[model samples]
Target chain A: MASRSPLLAALMRLPPPAPVLMAGSHLLTRLGRKMAGRHPGMIARLGPEAGKRLLLDATDLPALILLQAEPLSLRLFPRRAAAPPSDAQITGNLAAFLAMLHGESDGDALFFSGELSISGDTSAVLALRNALDDAEIDLAAEFAALFRAPETVVRRLAVVAGPRLGLSLTRMEALP
Target chain B: MMELVCPAGTPAALRTAVEAGAHAVYCGFADETNARNFPGLNFSRAEMAEGVAHAHARGAKVLVAINTFPRAGDADLWHRAIDDAAGAGADAVILADMGLLDYARRAQPQLRRHLSVQAAASNADAINFYAREFGVKRVVLPRVLTVAEIDEINREITVETEAFVFGGLCVMAEGRCSLSSWTTGLSPNMNGVCSPASHVSYETTPEGQDARLGGVLIHRTPAGGPAPYPTICKGAFTSPDGAGGRQTGHIFEDPVSLDATFLIPMLQKAGVRALKIEGRQRSRAYVAQVVRTFRAAVEAADRGAEMPVGALAKLTEGQASTTGSYAKIWR
Candidate 1:
């Protein structure tokens, strides 16, 4: 038989689905909530704060749109938000989010460079920085393990492609 | 007999080195306060305190590195690190930032402070300036200096000197490069992360493969070839020359580690106090093996025995090493 793809081989060897997804989703939710909570004031300013709807267009396959609030949750929003007016538009991919958190990329630059965008509240965007500064998300162990994982090829590819697409889209969006 | 200081990124690594005869083991909080801020590495405040106690019990000292520069308007975190290190019974604090060094010297006059290699004290004048102004007791010399330069520095300065003997190397002048900042906006001086993993990615493409960091294409290896990490200085790029020729491949350095094992006697004669081994991200097994090897070498040098042949060839990256600037050819 043809050798199973490396990623497939790795995934198949995983100890079943429920435990893996549960653990992964739990980590994601906890980190997302921690990030959101750390910048409560900023999170509040993004729309109504309590019920603000934000869209994160990852610009990658299996594109993700996140709706963030007091209790943070993530879902794949299909067909985009139809003129419903999002408080902010976080473009780019997971790498951009990671870079922004690491203080490597500023929100303003991300927005101006079209790596990220915002429409409803500029003050809300500023608040995001404040929140990140006040909060600490520990992803070192998780990130290290993820990098060492054999199935990391998919995510790694996305990390490389995401920023390229985001930058290109940002430029295209900026053109008249 | 000057003290031989070494690096330890984890508690297990610290204990391993201390047991294997490290006179001093330097570490940092599991955060940006240290240079080797790799994931799943470094010590917690409590762990540091415990490690200090253990090292002290074994007659070894613990030095804390708050080496990275403080961000603009965010000096409190750095200050807290200094206070925490002092409270944890650290033997000394290694610092790089002028402002932070000044702060530590003033705020805690009793805390012994050493200048970090990140400060890049390549010359005697700079070393003397830091010693005289900030009362720095020692200066970890940057890897760019030669044995003669180190001897010259010792002759001119009262402070002790330290140098790296093994592991990874930096080609750029420390504290000066902004490559990471230019691409990622996170300054290594301020953020203490170099070529942070968050911005790095490896992808397989029909046109071979690519490794990129922060959206910049750093390397493209052919299929079935090894892809080195996208460290900015070691990236492959095409620089068009004014003479209408283009240069490709590692404008700075090839993907190789530094191994200066053959230069120990020369370094000792040049008034070197400590020899550092990098790689805080390495396994405890790796740390134990390296510490044991170096410990034996140091002992052999003290007894005037013939130096042992190299035993760490397999541990080096890409199975290659360089004497780096210690031979002075680059200068």
Candidate 2:
């Protein structure tokens, strides 16, 4: 029930022109490649499912992301533009996507709660979710490890910023 | 006191459910030996052993589900599941197939046995037969029974009775429905999947979205409306109206999931020993939230306090719920 952080609000309101989207797409593609390198088991587990192009529509943001696991790529497009063809799609807010990526929230819970919606190939979407779950992709930790920053600093930043932004940024560990 | 039996689709969910105060958590192997054979779900053999250790360390029990019927020529897979569950130190094995029950009784006589709802034992005679023949210690009563009928069955049967208090409601008698098989060529009994996601697709239409199962148009929802999972039983069907025109609506049942939290007191009074929550195909978050909610409700029921109602509205399918056959509203 916390308000959206000013930084997130500003990002949401920012106009996503063609150049900006193209640049974001390039950056995401690089990030995706880096993650694929870090989590080889996740891609291997996906099998042929890694080839499917999954459209992730973040309703609270100004862009949509089309992701593919094999040969890792992530392309962003302006929200108002016509959607590209994809094998599956998941639609949700930015917070839901972030939380799911960080393992802080359950993907099935978000779907059941109507906070997220899925269309097209459900099996592929399920494969992606399972692959992600098995990988335990902690976004903050991954970024810190990738950039050689202090893990504690990154984790502490996520813990501090997550609630203020009404999002789950840190990975939720198993209950003791 | 009624024990809380929750579902755990994965090792993470098993730990979460146990931490959430579940007395016992039921799960299946990552195969068709049990029901809920969904993609990227269930536990591996090593994971099962670790999960059992985790639950036992936390003062909880793990019930391995070997409920699916064995294939005509492939009984070894089912037998291996039973053996693996016992090897993992599970507290009990829930069995539906008579052959599996016979095998478990003979092979691992020390392993406790529970009758699965998939067996659809709604009457005392069936319950007693399983107990007498298989030494089954408990029975997960089919969702078709009313509380009054449950009380009657409890009076006649010696084994403990477990009833589903939340999650999906099957209109057809469990273990008997062929609707999903007819549509998708898969069944909960054989393939361990109902309306298998591999056979499901969604198409955007001018009016809204059309959900199809096995290329059969099953449900259509308006734009911005909640679209329930494309289960054949809850699908919108067109039938004869008896007046020349056709009637288009849910012929078997609506898209409402079951929520009987308010009926805890009545069920407890009916001699129910355990309360089960469905959805092993769900995420750990779902498992945790539901387990916590039901744990509180069960404790409140034990104290003769009012049970919490409408706390899980958002979790129910179509954002709606019903008591299902528990109230016998259809009759």
Among these predictions, the greatest lDDT belongs to: 2
CAPRI quality band, candidate 2: acceptable
Candidate 1 vs. truth: CA RMSD? 13.2
Pick out the ten consecutive residues of candidate 1 chain A with the lowest summed lDDT.
Answer: A167-176
lDDT of 1 by residue, A18-136 (tens): 45545555666665665554444334333334454566665442334555555576544433334334665545555556555543343333432334433343334333443442232
Model 1 misplacement above 4 A = A1-176, B205-209, B222-227, B239-247
Which residue pairs in candidate 2 have backbone atoms (N, alpha carbon, C) closer than 3 angstroms, thus clashing? none
lDDT of 2 by residue, B131-186 (tens): 99999999999998899999999999999999999998888998899988998888
Q: Which TM-score does chain B of candidate 1 obtain?
A: 0.92
Task: List, residue by residue over B1-331, the lDDT tens digit for candidate 1.
Answer: 4365766766766886787778889888867877766544567788789999999999999999999988778889889999999999999999999988999999888999999999998898999999999999989999988888899889999998988888777878977778887898877777877777556655546776566778898877665443344577877898887799997778777867777777888888898988888766554445656777887777777776666656865556544678888886633
Question: Where is model 2 more than 4 Å wrong at Cα?
Answer: A3-10, A13-48, A78-84, A102-115, A133-137, A172-176, B243-246
Q: Over the full model, what C-alpha lDDT does candidate 1 score relative to the true structure?
A: 0.67
Best candidate, TM-score: 2
